[model samples]
Target: MASSVTILFLLLSIISMGGALASSKPSGSSDPLIGEVCSTQSHLVCTNYDDVQATSIAADQVATAASMRDASIQTINDLQEDFFLESSLVEGRKIAIHNNLNDPAPSRPFVPSSAVSSLPELTTYNALDIMSYFGVARDSSMATAIVTAAYLCGGAALPGEAKSCAASTKALAAFVASELGNNVSIYATKGAPTTYSTSTSHVKAPVTILKVAKGSVEEGRKIVVCHHLAFPSALYYCHAVTGTKVIQATLKTEGRLRAAYIKAMAVCHLNTELWLSRHPAFKALNIARGDEACHFLVENDLVFTRALQTSG
Candidate 1:
């Protein structure tokens, strides 16, 4: 199993950016989707986003760096074992993220994914070479998505972590069954985070806990945050850490004219020790590396929570 970070390097602007199996009932086709998914983006505001930082927030889910999508990559990870260059990877991510936030964006504007699924990868990416890893054409709309998926697949799993990349809902169902079980419900949101006036300065997509989901809630329940990966095709990276919480809520963001309603989810990873101190999320959330961190599941990110058992 490959760690999410292993894929982050590849997933971040082509270098940037889950699960299981068996004895499992698949989440039916009619299975309610967490929220909504958009293949193309109208805007992208996220910058150097990843779970590595405490304040990682998605301005838009599907938006990403244009360079990541169009760049041709090399197979550096395959040939070089000593990849995961912390400095280089971080720099590349910053550069790509800046590109994403700047004007004259990609043909398809995207709201950058503040999908704080996991920390950035240790290695860096060169692009395209690994596209072969996911078995997709370079010219395909899903080219960037496929390569990112491949990076996740090829990542090396770390201790106390179970990881995978599901290309379809069925695949995601299988991964969930293996990791969690049928006794769970999914949650998500497609709305913007509630805005507030800050004393110092206005932050980008701050994490706001509007309310709790209408359902049975419990403490210490196992949870999996299935972040909608940036794939042209439907691909999801469902992630669960040792200490995580999933809260489903009916949230209404402070719209410009009127309030808009949405079913939103907030995922909090209690274990922040795994991330690097320099990750931007930490600063965004106003916390240190060792402190607990929380972020909204933006861009159609889903949260699978253990459901209360009922007698038939």
Candidate 2:
């Protein structure tokens, strides 16, 4: 079970960190998006027409920057939602979790048969639908929200906005790290450790996989018990421990099997800026923040890595 989860996390991390799944076309020269110079005059007060015009232009630039930031956020949310849906296959693959597994016959009961002579019908859901129904999308959604927010801050029009965004992103990153059971926070705003090495190393936290094993086939009926295990970065050594409140809730509801699978996925090479560009709501607002964010950070060569199933 631990192995299964490791595989799942590794796979998901790949997708989450994978290059932007959605891309928009390049901006035409007719409408320039970047390097649009604004007047830099520092007037004591807007006493004259030129001064007022310059100040107004600066205000527009700031407003434009804000709009773009919002767009990037929307894109990240979409990606996160998509990631969970894709990961469901590995999360809910167990025989016990599938009603069809119980009976060899293709037809099984999903909705009860109205007539005695009628056969009990079965319903087969695709990978995404099954995951959605079980609410396995929570983690992906959360991760996306954090990543997108960070990207937005970095792309803010003014340098001040960028620094603030970076700081904010770092904070959200800390929050996500906590949720993922990692004590280390990459974002410094939360008072998390500032470094990750020996001399500079501030903290190290375990990434864990929760496993449940049903009774052996030889046994009359399979009774599955799942516990949590922590592993180093590579996920090779999973050490068992007591379940957290979240884990316990999942177990009681028989949802842990899928929840764990989803939680265990890790993402790699995620481009913070690119994700912000593909957000849907941003399109509705007539703003192209996602594209701008990518432009700002692609040069820095940013990449994100984490655990999960490779196939998801």
Candidate 3:
């Protein structure tokens, strides 16, 4: 019985060894099936379980690469769209400016006696003269004066018209106060209005006025001085100044007219500056186009962003 048991154990051991040899892969041997499955240069050994895992990993990598490529393309497309939109806005502003420059001057209504009466007597001063008197440079102060004059006169007074210098200076002071607040100093004459005060720090003006005889030739032919304190620049009697009349006439509501006039004057003043004229964005815009472009930009906030992008 013992000998029979020993023979059975030996037979079981030999069967187990044969099964292990059949399942194990030889170091130097390549399977025809594995070569066919792994046809690429990777030379990966393929088995039923390992082949599925390898294929899954490869597919995941391919999907990841494709997704990355697609995302990159989408990002590029978005950037291109943004660039085109900005470029179109810039072009539109340029065209608007050009058209405004070419348009004929608008007719202006006669200055009312009330407006004329409120004006104090002023010396005949051009843009440069006003800048000199104010002790400001030719760049921004001249523009501000022109805009201020237009606003105070309600767009009726011209540079050559008989207007009050004191009144215009007051208008300039008010303008500075409104826009810049306490950035400047203003000295008031005793018992006079704040507007009649002279500015000490930034704006300088003569205390004494050249008295003209009631019947003198200078009485009715008084010096016309209009300033835009916003621009701080001087302007001659031109369409930009006169165009404020168009705003007053076209708009039915007083509030709307005032708002439109302010916006238009701002553009006009900006156009007068040498830096703005040479600005890449405003290179195509000139003084002639100031009125229309200003209105257009004010109405379209998006376009205004493009116009003033480089202003800062």
List the candidate 1 regions with Cα displacement exceeding 4 Å.
Answer: 1-142, 190-216
| C-alpha TM-score for every candidate | 0.50, 0.18, 0.15
- Model 1 residue 242 CA deviation (Å) reads 2.6
Worst 10 residues of 3 by lDDT: 299-308
Q: After superposition, how far is residue 265 of candidate 3 from its true place, in Å?
A: 3.5
- Name the best candidate (by TM-score): 1
Global lDDT of each model?
0.38, 0.20, 0.21
* Model 3, span 197-308: residue lDDT tens: 2222122121211111111111111111222122222112211122110110011112122211111111112222222232222333332323233222111010000000
RMSD of each: 16.5, 27.7, 41.8
lDDT of 1 by residue, 172-253 (tens): 5556656676445554444332343312112332122234432233444566656555443345556555676544444333
**Residue-level lDDT tens digits of model 2 in 1-312:** 332111011211112112212111222322110111001121101112221110111122323223332243332233221121112223224312111111111111111112211211111112122223223342344223222333432333321111111111222223233333322111000001112232211122321222322111112211111111010000000111111001100011133332222112111112224334445434533444422111001101111222222374
Which prediction has the highest lDDT against the true structure? 1
Error of 2 at 297 (Å): 19
lDDT of 1: 0.38
Rank list by TM-score? 1, 2, 3
